[model samples]
Target chain A: MTITLQEVLPTYFEESRRHQSEIWGKQLTFNKGEYIKIVAPSGSGKSSLTHFLYGLRNEYNGKLLYNGQDLHGYSVEDFARYRKDHVSIVFQDLRLFPEQSVRDNLELKRQLNPYHGPEKITEMAERLGIGSKLSVKSRICSYGEQQRVAIIRALLQPFDFLLLDEPFSHLDDNNSKKAMELMLEEAAARGAGILFADLERIDFFPWQRLYHL
Target chain B: MALSFQPIKPLLQTGTNAASRWFSYIGLGIGVLLLLCSIQMYINIQQLLGGDSPRKDGHDFISISKTITDETMGQLEKNLFTEADIKDLEGKPFVSGVSPLLANNFRFQLSGGSLVPFVTDFFVESLDDTFIDTVPPTFHWQEGDEVVPIIIASDFLEIYNVFAPSYGLPQISESTATNLGLQLICYYPDGNRATFRGRVVALSDRINSIIVPKTFLNWANQRFATTKELRASRLYVKTKDANSPDFLNYLTEKHYKVNKDKTKFGRVKQVLQGIFSGLGIFGLLVVILALMLFSFYLQLMIARSKDNLQLLLMLGYSPNWLSTNVARRFIPVYILVVLFAVAATQLMQWAFHHFAMYDREELTTWLHWSVFATAGFLIALSLFTNYRMVKRLLYRMA
Candidate 1:
């Protein structure tokens, strides 16, 4: 699937802010099975960009096209289906249910499809170095561990595109590398694309294209 | 990715311990209690107004007589109800049947054998068999039958019990009175006398006079009366509704005297019916209010759990699925409440039957089938309403 953004400007940004930016009010397209990095400074609407693509926030100008169809035209149920079947996101805040155990959070995503199983969750958790923390409540886990859990949760579902809004901000280099390696392995196996957002570019993977905001 | 997770239990347990929900439960319990109590009380009052008589013939049969006055007493023939009067009463819209009470012209002497051999003259009045309340299977008597079935007024026993002790006579029980044998001798005007054994078959509160089978009375009157035709003094009018204003007005306009005791009973039944109807309306209002309160509580809970629900929705769970998870939590509570309410009502009914019921023999059970039907209706209504409310809230949130 291809997501095309035509002159997209968040409603929260002031008119002067849009004029000060190059990414806003510009036509851009993220294609399938392509690794792209959205590099931006702090307060440049990276999270807003990710939220718009994930169908979470709709208060933005411009027409977002998913495979040539207007994203605004999709009903709530249609958007839900699109999110479940095509787009997966690891939010900057890592919206994991605090009261649920880490395993439950992962299982909530994994159980949406028949191919993903508990063994896969365990394997991913072990690789992410939070295997032992899987049974602990997400509220009690460290921010880095919770971020790994959220990454594993997002990867559990089948998606055509993975949206990473500073997904490894709390993780150290090694943990971030491990998380990125696992994400690449899963995305490669499913022939999926990745949209990674960060303040600065890191030499984690060879990006086919990079955009600066 | 297979969505094989059983999120229902965990989701339900997450918000299961809301203390405010107890208010809804208590409200429901109170509503159910009021409804069940009203049902029970209505049934009890019905049994009470019906009295000890198992048959409901009293409502259909009205005893009417010509209004007695000094002028009519001086004119003896005017006191007796003519054939025209009977026809006029029978022509009324509410009147289904009309039967006149026939008095036996022959003199009958009743002697209690051996126990108390005091002889007394007794008058026998007979009406149509349809008007009699409790007719025994052996009430019919043939000419050759040795025993004659007699039904005595229940008030006669009450009066006898009141005065017999003062006169140093034994106050007999119903069974003893029924078993007591009496030798009946009929004295004809031509000096011919015939003897028959008499036994009390039943007791009647509706009929004021000593009653014999109409067939037996007809035969006895034919065999012993001096004249072929005898005018009736009292009439039994069967009406659809004894408490109808038109019937009462007609009775008043015609200057007919109705049995004050039975009419008072009819009035009491009407008043009791009104009371029960009012209680039923109140109970319904309480149940409706309780339902609204419960729905409001459910809405509040769903709102409180909005974040969890939205997270679930983001995970591809349909609003309907999440709504069902929320609704399932209340299913067990509702079932238990209904079960407990019905059980409590049944217990109350049991206590009423064993201790509170006046005529235990008349009503076999205190728990009427309507109670279960009403409970079932309530359960269905509450569950359906709750389910719908939960779904509506979830859909609105979606």
Candidate 2:
């Protein structure tokens, strides 16, 4: 799967800001099994760019093509199918259901694709140092724990591309490194690509290509 | 890897407000009950007005007489109806048929051991056999037959009961009076005498005089009368509709007196039917309003659950799928409401049958097919309306 952007400019962003960014009014293509990093300063529409790619935001100028098909022509059901089978996202806000436990949060997405099971979730939770918190409600968990839970939930479904929007903002350096390694291993095993957005680059993970948003 | 992929249960309970749901159910149930009862009452009134078992004379026939005045009272023979009067009555558009009543002129004495052992004069009147109700096969007399079959007026029994106590005579029951045989002695004006046995065959509330068979009257009147020409004092007029304005107006214009007691009673029945029909319509209106209120309540609940529904949609569930989940919650309530409403109607019908109309044999059932059909129609309408409302709300949210 590949996503191609041609001179894409979000409608909400000021036109003057486009001159400062390399991605604005520039053609970019993301291919399968490639890790790309979007590095930008604060207030640079990193979340907007992720939402646009995930079909959540459409108020943008220029055309977005998904595997040679125009994104604008896709119906709601088509978008839903795309999200279920091809693309997965870890939202910046980590939209976890407050009433459900971490396991329930992870199980909700896992139910859509049955390739992964509870043992995989437990192994990932143990590796992330949040195994004991899986049975507890997501609302009572710490921000870092919730972020880790969201990461596990996003990875539960089969996807060609994983979109991450400042997913490691609440984590410490050591935990972020651990989470990155876990994500890299999963993506490598599935032969999927990763689009990570952040304010700064981390030295531990190497990216095949870097774009300034 | 044993990942448990259970879809999360909804956080907000969609059981609905029990009190409000039940309140709506009760309101609807009462509406249904009122509708059923009104239909039952309307049927009962219809039976009373038109049923053949209770009314001795059908609504089609009416007995009429000329109005008595001082001049006509002084000359009673002048008031007697001739063949011209019968022909005139039959010529009217409303009058289907007319039969003149015949009266016995000879004196007759009735002597029975059990009751009425008097030797006074008794008068007998007769009309066409078709005008009488419940005519026995033996009412016709052969040449050798001496027993006479008579039909006495039911009001005559009431009058006799009222006067018997004062006259120091025993008041007899209907069964005993029917069984008592009386010997009749006819005294002719020429001093000839004859004897015959008499038996009461039937009783009638419509006919106000003693009724004998037309065959016997013609046979007896031929042998005993001084003249051959027969003049009737009363005539039974069969009209298409007794309450028709034209018939009443014609009777009034001719100064003829008709028995309007049955027609008046029929009018009262029609008024009852109108009132019950109005009440039934009111009940149906209440049911419609209650259903609207219930639909509004469901819309509110769906609105309250909008966030969760949208979240489910975002998780790749179709809007129709979510709507089905919401609709499933109310299906039981809908079934229960219909069942309860129908059950309450049936219970009311049972109570009416065993209690309210216990003595009325003509009213056999309070539950009519129309009642069930109406209730079924209302239930289906409510369920369909509710389902459509839910689907519309879900689609809008989507």
Candidate 3:
């Protein structure tokens, strides 16, 4: 499966901002099982592209196609099916139910489309060094701990592509490297691709092509 | 990964007032009870009145006559019913039999035993045998018969008993009156006199008249030849449904008068039924108001959890699944409330049958099938309404 962006420009951007951006008017495609990096400056719609690909934001000028069908036209049931099986996303805001524990947050998504057993939640938590914090509420957790929790919540499902918007923003270098290794290993096991958008280049991630936004 | 509503449950229940919802449940319970009780009371009243068993000893006989207004008062013949008028009444759907009341045309006087000698001028009439409540074998007369058997109205007998002492006369029992012999004298236009022996045979609750055999009255009217002719002024109408609104309204429209006592009681029954139906409608209004109140709580809950719901949707939680779970939470509650109403109705009916009605065969202790059908209808209605509301609220948030 491949996602194609056709001369896409956000509705909120100024005309001068569109001319200076490389991805605003260009047609680009990202294939399955391939790692692609987009280096976007501040206020450059890096999060907007992630939201648009996840079928969340529609305030854009041009079409986004997933497997040749317009992503904007996907019905609710179609989105549920594709989001369960085709694509997954982790927002930069780390949208976790604050009152719920780490185990509950992971179980919620896994229950929707279960590709793993109940034990996989504990296994993934332990591997990310948050297994002892499983019973703790996500709200009281530190920023770095919440970001890792969100990463596991997104990876609990089967997908052809995972959209990460500055996933390592709150993590230190060592933790960021650990979380990145887990994401890439999980992505490689299922032949799924990763579209990682961040403000700067990370030397650890092996990318096939780098687009400047 | 068990299917659990644990995560979304707390999110949905926030910001909702519990007391308001409890008040709604009470209102809903009262509404359902009123509706069911109204139906049961209707059936109970129907049993008490003539609605349950249509026949009482015999068919219902309604006495009808044209209203005697001032313009037609002195004109006796004009006020009497014509044959066409009788035919029109007989053709009505509610009427099964019609008999014109025949009266003795000649002047008549009856004198009973000589002790107090109950003597007075009296009028004699005859109606069809079918409409009479009680008919003895001896209540028959033929041409040239010296003995005449009569049927007297029981109400008239009671009235005479009440007033008999004032006139220095004795009050007679029903059996005594039946045995007492009497003299019936008739005078022709030329003042020639003829006499016959009269005896009472039966007392009737059906008609209020001094009833003789049709053969005797017709023959006497022809022999006496006192006035121009004898015209029937009233009729005995046999009907299946004496309390039918259509039949009564028809009589009113045509200026036909019926016995006031029977219709007075019928009017009372109608008023009671109207009250029950009105109360039922009022209860339904309360139920609807409660449902709307509960919907406000639902809106508050969803509105409070609007961000959580949007995030859940963002995580690929289908709106259909979320709505189903939300509605499922309340469907059982509605069913239990309706069942509570049904149980209350059943208890009331049992008490009515056991205490008020003395365990009569007229009413059943349990609820009627129609009551359960109403309960079922209410459940389905609540289900549809809840499902629709949840769907609309979720879709709006989306």
The number of the candidate with the highest lDDT is 3
The candidate 2 chain B region of ten consecutive residues with least summed lDDT is B1-10
DockQ of each: 0.34, 0.21, 0.45
Q: Per-residue lDDT for A1-213 in model 3, tens only?
A: 999999888888776766787788678888999999999988889999999899887898888999999988888767777787889998899999988888888888888888778798899888888889899999989988999999999898999999999999999999889889989988998899999999999999999889888
- For residues B89-157, what per-residue lDDT tens digits would candidate 1 score against the true structure? 889997888999988878877777777556778888888877877778878888777898988888887
- Per-candidate clashes come to 10, 5, 0
TM-score for each model = 0.65, 0.61, 0.78
Q: Return the interface RMSD of model 1.
A: 2.0
lDDT string for model 3 (B234-349, tens) is 98888876776667788899898888766665666777888988988988898898888878777787887888888888888878788889988988889999999999999999
What residue pairs clash in candidate 2, if any at all?
A117-B2, A117-B3, A118-B2, A118-B3, A119-B2
* Chain A TM-score (model 1): 0.96
**B-chain TM-score of model 2:** 0.53
Name the better of 2 and 3 by DockQ: 3
Candidate that beats the other on TM-score, 2 or 3, i.e. the better one: 3
User: What is the Cα root-mean-square deviation between model 1 and the actual structure?
Assistant: 9.3
Q: Give the TM-score ranking, best first.
A: 3, 1, 2
